[model samples]
Target: MEYSKHNIFSKVKDSDEYFLLNPLSMQADILNSVEAQRYKDKRIENQQEYFKKGYLVDPKAEEKLFKSKYLDFIDERDSDEIQLFFTPWYTCNFDCSYCFQDEYTNPDEKVSDAVMDAFFAYIDTQFADRKKYITIFGGEPFLNTPDRRASIQKIIDGANQRNLDIAAVTNGYQLEEFIDILKGARVREIQVTLDGTHEVHDKRRMLKGGKGSFDKITKGIDLLLKEKIPVNLRMVVDKDNIDNLLNLARFAIEKGWTKSPFFKTALGRNYELHHCQTNNKRLFSRIEMYQEIYDLVKTNPEILEFHKPAFSISKFIFENGELPSPLFDSCSGTKTEWAFDYTGKIYSCTATVGNVGDELGTFYPKVDLKQDLIEEWEERDVLSIPECASCNVKLACGGGCAAVAKSRTGKIQSADCRPIKELLELGIGLYSKHEI
Candidate 1:
């Protein structure tokens, strides 16, 4: 296969037929190469810069470097250009304990009309000559609020009328009600989370009446299916919900979703930060969990066909020789898209908004999509950020989840890079055992 060794647009070259090298051997190649040495020197210089910026590193040693074009994908931060986000309203009925925007004023405070008008106007001016997308989000988008629903309808109507792409990230509570409204809305994708089964999910995500919400949610999901909406189920994997994942996967497949064109599975990390609920905390044993899931897939190949394997985890294990979270490689709100709150505030990722200091900026009047602001949002001086610069996998990780890194470690400079490194090492061993 032809590969670009570094940047995606770099010169493509052919290699003679040769045996596959394990990750360790590849790392050895990286360390011995002049290019790799230059990368290391640059990395050290960046670390000094990070330290000067008040970032600190842990006592842990850095992982060995590996050579893989996969890391290049993370570094390709320049591909996407245009972006759009639609916040229907902040009136979700279910109160997920870990919700970052849980503290935002309820429906009463949302500028329902102004936001809709501004969004439509913004879309007209901003999206006229550039590729654009519309991402629908909210507290619980399907609430009984007329204004919220109206705003969402306008965006949907506008997008459809203009032949624009649309996607929604919702709690799935009112999915059924909104299904009909969205049927002709030019929506291409929808993401909804199912943390676990009824028992666990109900406790963590309940209604305003403090009632378990699994049944209604399932009903709403069925409603979505009836409307033929393309959907991907996002599961927030953590210590608490890990054990039940296999069963959850099985349940989804049994729903005749195995062969459904819309079927996809997204594994998420549990950032156990303040105000975030931790009821089902012990979701996985990290490495052990990866092993279990991998073994399960090997044992039941059908599951892989039924549900798209969690691409993030699989990439970390088989490709990157690392595992940060199941969805580590996903470009949340940055790469292909971004998030906007009901109040018209823009963020790189929805999860990082309320937590990541004053780094986030407002998008009310209008924000330029062609500027370098997106990359600047998480800029780290490798010389200044000790942990990230010293780590061999920093480029691939981009310093890991900014939210989790901040919430858990109380800083944004250093994140938990150990799990990803270990997973990559384990993957190398597994591949060697299989003679890959």
Candidate 2:
């Protein structure tokens, strides 16, 4: 027996303790200095408890077991529920500086009855037997216009007819206007982005005519909560607006939104999943973005109320008292998710949906697929990615986002490596008490 390559050790800052996590073994412990050294030393026979817990394994057989477990994971996930995204059109009323869709998704393409009819008809025939749900995605699905509202009505009606509950990803500027239409389907949750407090947010996410959207958006949030519908408040943060998260948190608390069980928060870092926008210098690398949140939490602990990032594995361990199943592939693209647009085009997932070149095929006007491209997306996983083969945290990060991976290396199976070790080290300290 020998120490497993999958074991991860994170040293506690300014202390003699270390956190040991093994994704493969599903085991963890806080190791003191001697224990940490003992783990590194060739004294496996001295640690019977570790042996039983899978920290120690036969070196030759470990790889075979991992591959077997990975197959089980894929089998289970491939049989899981599907999430279907419907993009009505790419037209938007507000102009946000860092919106990734701005370059590819233009306002000229609008949804018509013919397109909606084709989309719903296609999904009904293709996924009639699968356990699936609908997600209304956009340029702006809830825009305040007769035609746009009609599109929402049809989408909600069609999803309801199929007994599929719905979620929506929207800007929330016209949420109040779409409240009735939104209620047409069994609403799961609505994701609305509010980047910062009123003053800060207005400058970045402004209406086409230069009016600030904070007031209208807040009013809409209040309306949704009153209607007993759930709302997830998302903040697209970058260096420019990251500091304002604290202020926004205070505002949410002041508004009593934190009191409601229906309210939740998510932080979307402004980074390149595709090509970047101008002044992309403000973008924080993945770890740097999380590191900023950690610093903000130290400045005012209440920032955690707005967002509690799962920093690798600490939050899970703190809650479940056990390691979760290994993550063989983090990207859900062609596996359990798909996106359709009014243009009759099909995309692998939300991030790459509207971008012209990323389209896998079309759903409307015809039912066709580029099987070669589809196979590439479906084949992404730790085993398929070259960089992940010998990596320590392969099972943890699961090769990261396939869209981001492809953007960087132009290969769907490449690794968009995550700083799993660094994040786990910070996460343990951040979530645990007394710095012990």
Candidate 1 residue runs with Cα over 4 Å from true position: 1-76, 81-83, 104-107, 123-130, 274-336, 354-359, 365-375, 378-386, 406-418, 425-436
Model 2 regions more than 4 Å off: 43-45, 434-436
Each model's C-alpha lDDT?
A: 0.55, 0.86
TM-scores for all candidates: the values are 0.68, 0.96
C-alpha lDDT of residue 414 in model 2:
96
lDDT by residue (13-119, candidate 2, tens digit) is 44578988889989988888787877677554457787777778887788888988888998899678989999998888888878788887485667888888888
Which tens-of-lDDT digit does each residue in 1-436 have in candidate 1? 1111211111101111112112221221112234334443444334553333212222121121222333444455444445576666566777776675666555445555666667667658744665677777666666656766676777788788778878888888877677777887876778888877888788777777788878877777766766677787887766566666767767777777655766666777665554635454554545656565556555554545434333223234444454332122333445555566655566666665433352355556555352455554445323235675444444334455555555676655545453544454334333433421
Backbone clashes for every candidate come to 29, 0
TM value for model 2: 0.96
Candidate 2 pairs with clashing backbones: none
